[model samples]
Target chain A: MLPVRRSILGLMDRLMSFHRGSLWVGVVLVVIAPLSVALLLSMWRSPFPINEMISLLEDAESSTPGRFFDPTIRSWYRPLFHLTLWGFWNGSGSLLGGLHWFRYLEVGSVLVLLLLFVSYLRPRTGLQAAAALLAVAVMMGMPGFRDNLEIPVLMTLVGMPMALLVWMLLEREHRWWYTPLILALTMTAIGYKEQGLVIAPVVVGAWWMGSPGARRTTTAVVVLAVLAYLAMRFSTRGHWALFEQDVGFLFGELGEDEAAARFGERPWILYGYSALATIGNILFSEPSRGTFVITDHALSGETRPWEWISIVSSTLMTALIAWWGVAILRRDWSADAWSAESRLFVILVLALGASGALGFNYARDRLGGMAVPFYAAASYFAVLSVAERAGAASLKRRATVALVLVMLAGAWQLRAVGTLHDVRLRAASTHRTWITSPNWSRVTFAHRPRYLSIMQTMTPQGTDPARARRPTYPEWFLALIGGG
Target chain B: MPAGNTRILAWLIAMPALLCAVGLPLYESSDVAQPPAMADTFVEALDDRNVEHAYLFIRQGQDPNTLVRFRDDVRTGGREVQVSPLMLAVAGSDDNTAAMLLSFGARMDYPPNRYVVCLAREMGMDGFVDSQMSTASEVECPPPSGAEFPLLAYVD
Candidate 1:
C-alpha cells in the first residue's frame, strides 16, 4: 500500500508489455533500408584524406595490409572512421552483406537513438517529442554519414558518455566493472587516436548530470585517468615520447618560422577560431566577422543537405541542452526541480554537451561530420521526441492504424535510405591469386560467397560482349574439360 | 471492430508478400545478373606481385604454406622465399595495420609516426613478429572498400 511499492508495480507492468510487444521486432527489421543508403553513399562518394589513406591501406612498403608503426601522429581520427566501417561489417557478417546489413544497423541505430531520447522526454522535450521524432525521421530519410547511418558503430568511441548516462539514469546499484570498461575505452581511444579526447568531456558531463555536479565518482574517474596515463607511460616505457629536439625538428623542418619560412602561419587564437568554426558551422548557424568562417555542410563537400539536417537537429537539441545546463547552473529549473525528471534532463544535457564538444574539436578534422558524439546527441534528440507518446489506449484505432502505417513507411524509408547506404562491406584482401574466377567478386565486395559458382557462371556478360558470347566453363564443365 | 482490424492486418501481411514475390524479384535480376568476376576480394586477382598478395592473404587467415603453394603453382621464376607468418602482427592488429604496416616497411626506414608507443599501445601492438599466438586480425574498413582503394589486387 506504500507509494514507493505502488510506483514499482506500475513500472514493472510497462516494462513487461514493452518486451512482449510484437512491433518492437518489426521496428527493428524495417529500419535497415536507411542505413544501407548511408553506407553505399559514404563508400561510393569520394574518400576523405584519400591520398594519405590510400597509401595507408595499399602501399606494401609503406605499411600496406597493416602498419608496423603509426604513420601519422593523428592516429585517432583515421582509425576511428575505419572502426565504424568495421563494426557494420563485423556485426552483419552472419546476415547477408551490403545494403541489407547496412539497413539493419541503421534502423537499429535510430531506434536505439530514439530510445535514448525517450528515456528523457518527460524531463526535457516532453511536448515536442512527436515533432522532434518526425523531423529526425524525415532527416533520417536523407542519405548521409551523419544521420541514422554510419555513426552508430563508433559507439565504443563516441557513445561512452551516453552509455554511462543511461546507466546512471537507471541508477542500477552494484556497478563495479563499468569503470574498467570506460578506462580501457578511453585508453584505447588515446592509443587508437587523439580523437579519444572526446571521451573525457562526455564522461565528465555524465558525472555532472547523474550526481550533484561532481561526486567522489568523478574524482575517482579523474584519478583513474592519471593512473591510466601513468600506466600507458610505464607500459610503453617512454618510447612514445619524442625528444623536444625531434618535436622542434618535425615542426621546424616544415619551415614555419617567420624569419625562415612556413606553410600558412596564423595566430593560435585564429587557428583555434578557424577549427572551432569549422565544427560550429557544421553543427549550427553562428554569424562571425573574423577571417575564420565556416560553411553549411552543403558547401563543405563532406555532406548533403539531409546530412546537414542531422547537424541541425543535433544543434537545436544542443541549444536546448545549453538551456538546460544554464537552468541548472542558474538554479532556475522550475520550482519542482531536483525531481526524477529534472535529473534525467540534466543527465542527457550533460552528455550532449560533452560529446558534442569532442565531435566539434578533436575529431572535427579527420572524421569531419562523421564523428560519434554529435550524431549520437542528434539521434538522442530525435528518439526522445518520438518515444514519449507511444502509450495510451484511448486514441481512435483508425488514427492509430494510420500512424502505424506512416511509421512503418517512415521506418522503411529511414532504414533503407539511411542505414543500408551506410553499410561498409570491408572484405579482407591478403594478396592471393587463388581467386582467379568471378566467384571471388562476392568476397571482393564483402558479400558472402552468397551466389555459388554455378550462379556466377550463369551471370550475364558485361559490356565486353565477347565475354558473355563465349561459353563460360561451368563447375562440372570445368572439371571435365580441364581434368584437374 | 474485429472485421476492420482483421482487414487491416490482412492488407499489411499481403503487401510484404507482394513485395517479396515481385519487387524483390525485379530488383534481384538487375543486381544478380552481374558477373561473378566483379565480386572477388581485392587481393585475389593479382599475378604480378604474388608474394606480396600471398603475404596479404596469409595474414588475412589463409595459411602461409598455401600461399607458398599458390606461389609455386604460379611459377614466379625467382627463388622461392619463405614468408614469416609472424610478419602479419607487425602492423599491430589489421585494424591498426598502419602502425604494423609502417613496421612492415620499417626495413626500408620509413619515417615512423613518433607516437608509435601510445599509438601501438592503443592498437594493442603485439610484438610477436612470428608468434602463433596473436591479437585478432581486425579488418577495420569493409573488405570491399579495401578492394577499391589503394590496390584493388596485389601482385607477387
Candidate 2:
C-alpha cells in the first residue's frame, strides 16, 4: 500500500513539474478534444443543400469560373469564397458528400486554432493543459461557434482567425522573403472575407515589437499589403455599404425602406451600440439580439436552468484573466513581463475589440467568431501565467481542486453545446424550418425563383428520386448501433 | 534563411498572382446565362387555377414549394403576402391542384400558423388536410392577432 502510494505521488509530481516536452502533452489533448467531440456528437450528419447552402451550390453550378471574379454579379466580392463554393460542389461528387467535406474543413480550421494555441503559448504544466481544455470547452459553448457549425456560409468565422494566427506565427521569423509570404497570406485572407483587414493591426503591432532591424521592412510590407487590399476591394465599385440597412426587415417589424431610413438617422450611435454589445456578448456571455436573433434560446431569455453555467464559467474565467493582468502590471514591470504570451494576450484583446468594431451594422454572435479563438488563447495564457508564478508546491495543492472544478464546468458547457447542436441537427434533418426560416431568407439567393428551381432538382449524385431523403439522427443512430 | 523557405517563398508569391491573372479574365470575360422563364408562368398557372398548366410547369422543373409574393388587394387591404402554391390551391378549394402539389413533395408545414388547416377545413377539404397532418391529432386554431386575415400574413 505504501509503495503504491509513493508511486502515485511520484507520478503526480513529475506531471506537475515544468518541462518543454510536457507542452506536447497539452498539444495532444488539444487535438483529441475537437476530434472526439466531433465524432461523438455526429457532426457530419448535417443536412445539405438547404438555405443559402443550396443557393451557393446552385450559383456555383451555374456560373463560369470567371463570374466569381466579376464584382457586378454579387453585392459583395469574395472571389475565393465563390471559388470555394465551386470547388466544394465539383470536388465532393454529390451534395451530401459536399456537406461532409464542408464539415471536415470547418473542423480542420478549428483544429488549426488549437494547434496554433499550443504552438504560440507552449503550456508546460498539467494545470495549463486543463486551462486550455477548459478554453476549448468554452469556445464550443459560444453562440458564434454554434452558429458557424450549423451555417457553412459563415466560413469566415474560423477562416479569418486561422489566417491571423498563421500570419502571427510566421511574422516572428523576419526573413527578407517573408514579406511576400505575408503579402500572399494577406491577399488570401481578404479573398476569404473583407474583415480579414482586421488582422493587419495585430500583425503590425507584433512586427513593431520585434528586432529593430526588421521593423522598417515589416512596416513597408504591411502598408503595401493594406494599400493593395484596399485597392482591390474598392476599385471594382461593387455595391458598397458600411452597414446592412434592412434592420426592420430582419426583425419583421418594418419595410426595408422604412428600416433603412430609421437606421440612417443615427447610424453611428447604432454601430457603437452594436460593437459594445458584441464585445459584452463574447466576454460575459450576455445575449445580444441586435443582429442575429435566436428565438426560444436560453441566451435570449431572461434566465434559464443551464444558462447560469455559461454565464458563470465565462465571467469567472474573464475575471481571473483580469486579475492576472493587474498582478502582472503591478509586480512584473520588467522587459520580461511583456513576454511573447503577454504581448499576444494584449494583441488578442485588441483583435477582440477590432472584431467588435467590425460589427458595423448590428451586433451578432457570428461576428465574434474571429475573436472567440483569440479569447480562448488569452484564457489559456492567463491561467498558464498564473500557475507558473504560483510555484509548483503551492500550485499542486490548489490545482487539483481547480482542475476538478474546471472539468465539471467544461462538461456542463459541452453538454449545453451538444444539446443545442442536436436541436440544430434535428431541424436540418427535417428540411423544414432550416430552409424556410426568416434568417435564411436574408441570404442573397433565397428569394430568387430561378434558383429555387435548381434547388429542388439537386440531390446526392447517385440517389434515386424516390429514395432521396434527409435522414434524421435517430434513423442513423438506430442503423449504426441498434442494427435497424 | 533556409533552402526550403526560399522554395516555399517562390511558390507563395507566384501562386496567388498567377491564379488571379488566369482566373480573373475567365470570370470577367464570361457571364452566366439566365435560367428558363418557368417560375413566373408556374405562378400564373396557380393564380389562374389551371391545374394542368401548373402540373406542366412542375414537370418543367418548377418547384411546388416555391413561395412567390402576390398582391392580396381584396383580401388584406392591398398588402403583398408571400404564399406557396399549395396555400393558393387550398384557399381556392382547388383539390386537384393541392393533390398535385402534395404528390410532388410539397411540405404542408410551410404556413406560419395552424390557420391554413383551419382554412382548408372551412373549404370542406378535410381529406386533404387529414392526409397532410397525419401525425397531428387535431389542428389547434388560435385567434388571429392582426386586423387582416391570418392566412395572408404580411410581408415587407
Candidate 3:
C-alpha cells in the first residue's frame, strides 16, 4: 500500500511537470475547446437548402469520373469538393449522417487551422506559446456570420484552410522537388475553388520576395501548371465567353437590360457592394444580419440607424486592425516577421477583394474560408506586438499584462459567440413558428404540397416525379428536430 | 524568476480565460426557456408567405362581415398579392397596429392586380387577430413591379 501510494504520487508529479502538462493543456484548451464548441453548435443547425447540395452530390456521385471535368454538366470546376462530399456521403451510411459528419469536418478544419497558426508561430518560449494559443482561441470563438454556417458553405470553408495549409508548406519547404510539389498542390487547390488559382500569383510573389534560390525553377513549374490548368478548364463545356460576360457585367459596360438578358436582373452594383460588404460585415455588424441587409434593403434609397452603425463600425474596426498591424510591422523589423506578416496581410486583402469581385453574391460562407486565415494572422500580429512590448516590463508585470490580454480576448469572443447563439435560437423559433402555426401551415400545405411530398420521401436523390407522391423531409432533418 | 516559471504562469492565466470564453457561451446556450414573442412569429410567417399562420394571428376578434369581405376580395382578385407584416414592424409599427398594404401588379391570370392591406392587432395574450380581421382596400395596380403603393411605400 505504501509503495503504491508513493508510485501514484510520483506519477502525478511527473504528469504535472512543466513541459508535458502545460503542452497537453495548451492543446486541450486551444484545439479541443474550440472544436467541441463547433460540434455543439453544428448540432443545433437546421438544413438551409439541403436539397440543392444533395442534388449536386447525387449527380456527382452517379456521374463518371471524366464527367466532373465536363463543363456542360457543372458550371464550375470543383471536382475535389464534389468528390469529397461524395466520399463523405458514401462513408456515413445515410444522407443525414453524412451531413452531420460534414459539419464535424468543418469543425475539424478549424482545428487544423489553429494548429497551422501554432506551427507558424513556432513558439520557443512559454509566453509566445500562450499568445499563439490565445490567438487561436479568440479566432475560433469569434462568431461567424450565420449564412456561412450552413452545410453547403462548408465546402468553401473546408477548401480554403486546406489550400492555406498547402501554401504554407510550399513556402516553408526548400527541397529541389518543392517546385513540382508546389505546382501539384496548386492544381489541387484550384480543383477546390477557382480562388485556388490565386495560389499561382502568391507563389510568384513568395519566390520573388524571399525564395530567390529556386526562383526560376519554381516560376517555370508554376507557369506550366497554370497553363495546364487553364487548358483543362477551358476544355470543359462552358467557354471563356461565359467568364467574359460576367466580367462585362462587373465593369457595368452592360446595361441593365443587357445584363438581365444575359444573366437575369442582377446588377453589377450588387456584386460590387456585396464584395465590399463581405469585409465590412466581418469587421463590424452583428453576425445575424451582416452587411447583406444593407445592400438588399437600404439600396432603395432608404437607410436605417443600424445600417449606418454597421457601416461606420465596420470601417472603424477595419482601420483599427490595419493600423495595429502596420504599427507592429514598423516596430518589429525582423526579416522573418516582416516577410510572414506582409505576405499574410497581402494574401488576406487580395483574397477578400478578389473573392467578392468574382462572385455574384456576398455570402458569409464564401468569405468565411478567407476570413479564418486573415483573423489568425491579425490575432497573431496583435499578440506578438504586445508580447514584444511586454519584454520591457518586469516578469511579473508582463505576466499580469498577458493575463489581462487573454481575458480581454476571451471576453470579446464570448460576446460574439453569445450573439451568434441568440441569433440561432431566434432562427429556430422562427422556423418553428412557420411550421406549427395554423395560418402559415395552411398556406404551406396548400401551395407547397410538393414540399410535403419531398419531406415524406426522405430520399436525397433519384426521386421520380411520377413515383414519389408524398412530401417528405430528410430523416436527418427529422432527427435534427427530435422527430426521427 | 525562472523562464520556465514565467511560461507556466502565462499558460495558467490563459487556459482558464480560454475555457471561460468558450464554455460560458456553450453553457448559456443550453437554456432554451425563453421563446420568441407571438408578434415576431407572425412577422416571420408573413415574410415567409405562410398565409395560414399569418391569418391565424390577424383573425382574432374580427367581425364576420370583415372576414367575409377579406376572403371575397382575395378570391375575386386576379393577381397574387403579398403583404409584408415584418416590413411594417421594421418601420416602427407597434404591437397594436403593425400592418402593411400589399399591391399586386399585372400578372398571368389577372391583367391588373389590386391592393390589399394586412393589419395586426394584439388580442389579449393569445396572439394577433386572424387574417380575416386584417384590413383590405382596393387600389389601382402600379405599372411596374418596383413601383410602390401609398401605404407600402411609406412602410418601405
Which candidate has the top score in TM-score?
A: 2
lDDT, candidates in the order shown: 0.35, 0.56, 0.48
lDDT of 3 by residue, A273-361 (tens): 54564554456542222234444446666655434444443443355458666764564556444456665665556555655554444
Q: Write the per-residue lDDT of candidate 3 for residues B1-156, one digit (tens) a residue.
A: 456556655565366445655665554455333332234455454444543344345444221111111111222233223333432332232332222112111111221112222222211211432332222224233432332222333222
Query: What is the C-alpha local distance difference test score of candidate 1?
Result: 0.35
- Prediction 3 global C-alpha lDDT: 0.48
Which tens-of-lDDT digit does each residue in A99-148 have in candidate 2? Answer: 56666766566556656655555545444444555555556566565555
Give the per-residue Cα lDDT of candidate 2 at B93.
75
Is model 2 an incorrect, acceptable, medium or high docking prediction?
Answer: incorrect
Task: Summing lDDT over every window of 10 consecutive residues in candidate 2 chain A, give the lowest-scoring window.
Answer: A461-470
lDDT of candidate 1 over A335-389, digit per residue (tens): 5335333444554444334433433321222222223334334433433322232
Looking at model 1, residue A27 earns an lDDT score of 37
> What C-alpha lDDT, on a 0 to 100 scale, does residue B133 get in candidate 1?
19
**For each candidate, what's the DockQ?**
0.02, 0.03, 0.10
Backbone clash tally (model 3): 28
Clashing pairs in 2: A66-B26, A66-B27, A67-B27
Model 2 has a DockQ score of 0.03
The window of 10 residues in a row where model 1 chain A has the poorest summed lDDT is A242-251
